[model samples]
Target chain A: MDKMVYNFSAGPAMLPVEVMQQAQAEFRDFNGLGVSVMELSHRGADYMAVAAQAEQDLRDLLQVPDNYKVLFLQGGGRGQFAAVALNLMGKNAKADYIVTGQWSQSAVAEAEKVGQVRVLDGFETTGNGPRALADRWDLDPTAAYVHYCPNETVEGIEYHFVPDTGEVPLIADMSSTILSRPIDVSKFGLIYAGAQKNIGPSGLAVVIVREDLLQQACPHTPAIMDYAAMAKADSMLNTPPTYAWYLAGLVFKWLKREGGLEAMGERNKAKAELLYNYVDASDFYSNNVHPQARSWMNIPFQLKDDALNDAFLKEAKAEGLLALKGHRIVGGMRASLYNAMPIEGVQALVAFMDRFAKQHG
Target chain B: MDKMVYNFSAGPAMLPVEVMQQAQAEFRDFNGLGVSVMELSHRGADYMAVAAQAEQDLRDLLQVPDNYKVLFLQGGGRGQFAAVALNLMGKNAKADYIVTGQWSQSAVAEAEKVGQVRVLDGFETTGNGPRALADRWDLDPTAAYVHYCPNETVEGIEYHFVPDTGEVPLIADMSSTILSRPIDVSKFGLIYAGAQKNIGPSGLAVVIVREDLLQQACPHTPAIMDYAAMAKADSMLNTPPTYAWYLAGLVFKWLKREGGLEAMGERNKAKAELLYNYVDASDFYSNNVHPQARSWMNIPFQLKDDALNDAFLKEAKAEGLLALKGHRIVGGMRASLYNAMPIEGVQALVAFMDRFAKQHG
Candidate 1:
């Protein structure tokens, strides 16, 4: 009997309905403990178990190698932008950043504060359409790491293949695209993502780093931000965002029940294809990114006439489709189809778009 | 009805039952928006209203001066430890740290990473039975600032009056004692608290800094940690811990309903007096801290027989008085009576302690 709605906000995006239901069901009393999970001490057994199981579930889902240390930390992707530089560039003092879009460019700004940063263009665009990801980059072989963003939420660009960094450690900010399918944990020196998108909520960031890379953190690094220190403390170096971590655990369980990353990958591909295909077929709407570079997580499309932007959003809200307004930088519309966004939502979005186009044609 | 439980956690502690209930009731569909508050975009109108209202309510409760900028940020007290040093000691590169206990000592380590730190003994204990707070300290007037922890959670020491630092800016880590009572906000240059105790949850730290103190951040300071940058962006430089922030707003509203901090101060004083009075009267239990220095927030006591510690905790848990175990450094029992802890909880704890002492006497 509840009104049906599908949210399409880019980050701090939607999570599975089932996870939300279960969280509500036990919001006050967790595990019959007579307190909200958020109220429990992180050092206590009940909370430790919750923390450990969430890590285990994430490890199983990612099939992470034994040599990597998984840390759940506070501060979002921007925090890790500084943390990565502070943690890894201590000895070498330099790294290469492949600038893809807004997120990756922002990461460069943070890294520049810590050490030497070489910025390389991540993609080439013809006009304002058909942006092709640059497979080859002029990387510094002796750099501490090669950092890049796999999916750019603002520009709706993504890499279909991971870049090969050879001897240099490859680091990825997968904030928008992580857990969408699968990743090779051994391929990168580290992978960090803000948990707002596919994982759980904002305020928590998950970092998976090779144990060997953990030794060279800057002496001045805050113990909380020092990867080595946090790894040693098992990410309890400080009281973590406990509620967000709990919610992430619920999401991980939902992922497993829905057949893990493999099934999620298939569903996500189908959903992205549904929206992209409809956009390609329409004269009234179009997505600018190249087919190969178009993101499966965020699809940004523009209306033929920008004047109808408000009307489109208003009508969409009336029908219970939400957050379709595009980023100010790219003015039009964006429908973020993360792992939690079911195919039906995308179908509904496409149906709305068709009707909107017909009404304004 | 759910079982009654009073969680005595140090941080990531208890919140008002009404706030928790409201949060749970709206967990799935916040404000009938058909999406969890966590799922809403921080940049959106709905979440912005929530964020703004929280800050306004906090300002109203504290009577914060117009010159102070309040920031809700990620990472806990420890994160702010580094942030305070990085933000304040940029030009001067030195500060006096009055060491009170574990939390203050930890802050010194982080500050030492940034600049020269003078560690002044905060209190003197005579034979571990009575500790007296140092009324005056050998301070550096030319230093960037004077830093101290108002209430030490682990050692159960608290300052009844603020330390005078003349022209030097005074910063208080009020993580344990903030919002339990009324204080003159204008007396200190800056005040910060990890939200778990008196605010909301673990992920957020609330910082109230004088406008003049916001400048002079180290260039290398991560934007996420940079006070000026965070203030300029309204703590939205990145997606904030939206859910925790919302819950904190709910808590501020609850405080208003409960007659604000003045009423809270009276209630807390009564609660602390009841437990401390009972301990003072009992030969089987004793608290070593000087009455003048004893913490109203954290009260640590010792059993006459150390072997009965486990039994005490087990029995207390059964009676729903949870997390009474003391810190490892201070081996005894600690009961954190934060703002959310009602007088009834303290009464229950005292009655249980009396019965336990008689049984083991």
Candidate 2:
């Protein structure tokens, strides 16, 4: 029998086991149609039902307002960095970006290509060694939008509270934190998440945008990237990533069956806390981010001795804990406890770390 | 026993039975790692092998020259419409588009937004009702590139020969017809195909661009859409459609096992001939495409009586022949014989068409 395995990749991360099983079972024959759901045309009734249900389920899970448009688009979070700028910066041609970490910093680079961008620091070094989220930023009342990364996947930094940008539309790149918990959908003007993490799979991004913000896209914006055009067509402006969208629907159904985002939020919190608690208690393993700012989804922890990093990863892989290596820029280990990751996986990682620590210590 | 099923959806269409079965068997535990391939990180060695192998196999299949870069990207064929214009128009800021059908016309619209566009009619009305491919176009030598859709999926039109554009790069959107037959890769400056039809799933697009054409992308082009940036990163500028890319790799392997594009071309020709010959022999059903310009991939046929359309579709579905309805713009039925479609399926379709005609006649 195969041993239990846990994947801890930051994005293109794990999906619910139930969702994966259902998708596998129906990989070839969907709804007794004897054809793979992926084989169905996007415009056809069969695939359309799947697409609409996925969107509706996502809406229900998030409690999205009727005035908002949930777009299942191609390109990941990076694509949205440019798309957001092109779509919203047409009239105003300027925005304020909160530079939190690698992701928000990348957003600024893309936004600068289109129009004026003012970068605001998202964090400040506390009196202690760890960094904390900045509570306030200089206001840009006339800006088109205030874009920020609610959860930075690379650095494992996240904001617990939504930054208020009164009168200015607040946009969050929720690629890592989305669906891990419920948020007040009406609070933000737009929220975009790459489907690799807390959603379904790669090749699909979910954009929840207020209806009023859909207009004023630059004329030169690619139709595929134009939010207004995509919103009007219900995100089928072109052939969407159909199979990913279908798999996303299965994931949504699974989420609904597991008592929606409320249940998922509670479960995700418990999972994140299990690892963070273990790391805090152990001198052998340490997470550098401030307790309040540490990500609930991606938890980056380092061993006390950097020399043992290779051995730790090797030993962990032998025990079926995969993809624990952190981003090269911040080397150590990252255990991404996305919505799909059960607490058991975190427990296993903690157990492995304890075993490794004692042998090395 | 379950009846045999044949799917004829134009895109997100039928995949090889062998590939689908293999993928299904291993969907949950890729490479015996006990995790789906979709869950694998693009940066990881496992998935990078998969990505690289797919590109290599595609290169091998096409005999692509060393001077070109093969990029697996997001945003489908329509995304490429904008990408092509944005990438190529930076230097010259103008291009000639040979408008063949709906697809090429749509390309013109996207290109017009990016730069100056000249639409050259791709077809001339023949003495008969059918349209023939125009031999000569008012060429623009100073233009950066000349773009055309080799196969129009909606209208079932195809170019039998490559157009000569002296000193200017020629770009072809082979979304519907790519990998169905072999072609000279060296002839064109760039060739892109949306994966839904002849490749794998919907989200991925395969772009083969000459290295020389990569550098001229507009300053504001999204990094995800910029060929030079994507090429440099090996199409990993951001999280790619990992699962779709894996599936495409499986497809490439399957194509190689099936004796590459040479074998696929012969089989496709036979499949096209079978359907076209059957339609030509029948008075009750007719194909409007000129013989010389008929698409080898998508064949649109009309019944003598439009009243029988719904009945025909219903009856076809009952027999496990699915998605035969044509694009709304072109009424009737479209049978897309992509590479994954076997000769037996075409034979089954012809047999069904014969049975439907006699009963309705």
Candidate 3:
């Protein structure tokens, strides 16, 4: 066994080993610049190269249209929740939010502060069980935009269908779901993802917004959160999350080398299937979420015998698996299989689970 | 000369070599935890240690009073401009701003979005000249707070005296000035600094706000931007910039080991004086700012002959002194001497300036 364990955190989850190694080597000096990437100015040639390439790579990966402005922002997923509302809400504006999970609820609530918010109640959460189909969404016609999250980290629910809001724009918080599956950027007016999971680190938030949406910020919008100002400044309205941008750029390159999103989606799907299949086959363990709504990124399952919860976690840690304990909001074990987690890691996890289950059962 | 060049960019400045080395060593694996700090969940025990220690060290360095809360936030320094107004402008309906330079102007513009803005204009063009002092400032009593930046990074202007606002809380954006000198925490109601310059990376913004100022956030503040939410969540309202926070902790240790703020202040003073004295003595180079208001952190100077600017920059690069090229807004060379820049780097810059001046003259 390796000296260190495999960590399965939800958001700030595992990073690519090769990427981490490269980052480690470049921590003191970057491209003969004689200083760490973090130590370079945001506007300098060195960091500008880092920023430019990152945006290009992301655009290429997502096939982001020319009509969209790619923005690198801060304040994580939560910060973007506020930014989206402040930037999109205009005079006499209202937004329609599809309440799929925690993030969507937060977004709708935050938007209500700046403008009117109408929850669509799109996906139903039955004791964190199977989620409703996206076609069942009840969107408001008066909305400036319809907001939803493609994937919910804690509830492990993902939308299989996209809502057609007609002329109204679609905004998605793809913090957990980005890069894990193929996405149609043209379908959404705006899409923002925190960089902690599939991209790189926690500091940078990436926003892909259609050009038309950029001009409608509420008069009271903060300049940093103003989409138009950010697009005008090339996302350097202030000193950006430089190091995070650099790292995400590297992750983008890695994604390109690994055959882009289609390939990533297949691999992620396979990994999730492997883990979920194992859990389903065993009478000792069961996944609570409906299979159709199940997320490929986060696999949340609970042991049939509740008494083994502590023992399961303790033994899992002892066996070199770490952070498998589910989120406090949902009690059980959650194995978040992000892009970085190879198929082999899932196999290993399944093997460990099988052995532990056979003994505990 | 040392193998590495001195970085003099205003922001995303040099970090301590020890901290860099430590980061490099621990980049792939943090404290034998097997995953990089960037890969850990912000709420995890290990990362919480990083957050706690970073805040504690900052408190120790500032000798912050118990009533103040030091928050680690995102959106760079510019983001804080909006967050401050969003959180602090509730008590009264307006905020008073003392405009010193471009950054202060940005702050005033942002605060105008949330509440009424009272602009204190004299300092922008002439207050920090040879005849000015901080005591002569006219402040508003009904204003929520009087905001100012102690140092104008681009203008190379520094405040020698803290403005006394009496019952009106004094809020200063110390993004470019913090950790360069000793500050009495009790003097200001709130102090905020961007981490890129004197602290760590660009993603994290450190805010030191008095306790009494925490509660009056506008009813609908986002969890991440709400000062009370941040204080309660310990700046992990969402996942923080983990690695940046960790690096800051190392910088704090380095500061304490290097004999604390007094020792750092002495070195900074000496470094600034060395450059200023050279500029004053030499006819080839001149700094337009009044001597009393010249900044210790950023020293902006211009060559008498603008034609030599290109040659000066090229020669400076060849001599291993970098980022001497000034901002486009302020057309001249700017040498940012942060805490990490050793005394020898300043000496080398002065010596290079002398050689260049002698040749040009």
Using DockQ as the measure, the top candidate is 1
From the highest DockQ down, the ranking of the candidates is 1, 2, 3
- Looking at model 1, residue A143 earns an lDDT score of 94
Q: Model 3 clash pairs? A: none
Candidate 2 lDDT by residue in tens digits, A1-361: 2788889989889899899888888889998999898899999988899999999999999999999999999999999999999988857699999987899999999999999999988854244322333444676899999999988888898888888888999999999988888899899999999999988899999999998988788889999999988988989999999989988888889889999888988998899888999889998898888766888999898998899999999999999999999998889999999988888888998898889989997
**Docking band of candidate 3:** medium
Residue A147, model 1: lDDT of 95
Lowest lDDT 10-residue stretch of candidate 3 chain A: A125-134
What clash pairs does model 1 have? none
| Winner on DockQ (2 vs 3) | 2
Docking class of 2: high
Checking candidate 2 for backbone clashes, the offending pairs are none
Query: In model 1, which runs have C-alpha deviations exceeding 4 angstroms?
Result: A127-136, B127-135
Per-residue lDDT of candidate 1, residues B131-206 (tens digit):
3334446788899999999899998988888888899999999999889999899999999999999999999999
lDDT value for model 3: 0.85
TM-score of each: 0.98, 0.98, 0.97
Chain A vs. native, model 3, TM-score: 0.96
Per-residue alpha-carbon lDDT of model 1 for A228-287, expressed as tens digits? 999999999889999999999999999999999999999999999999999999999998
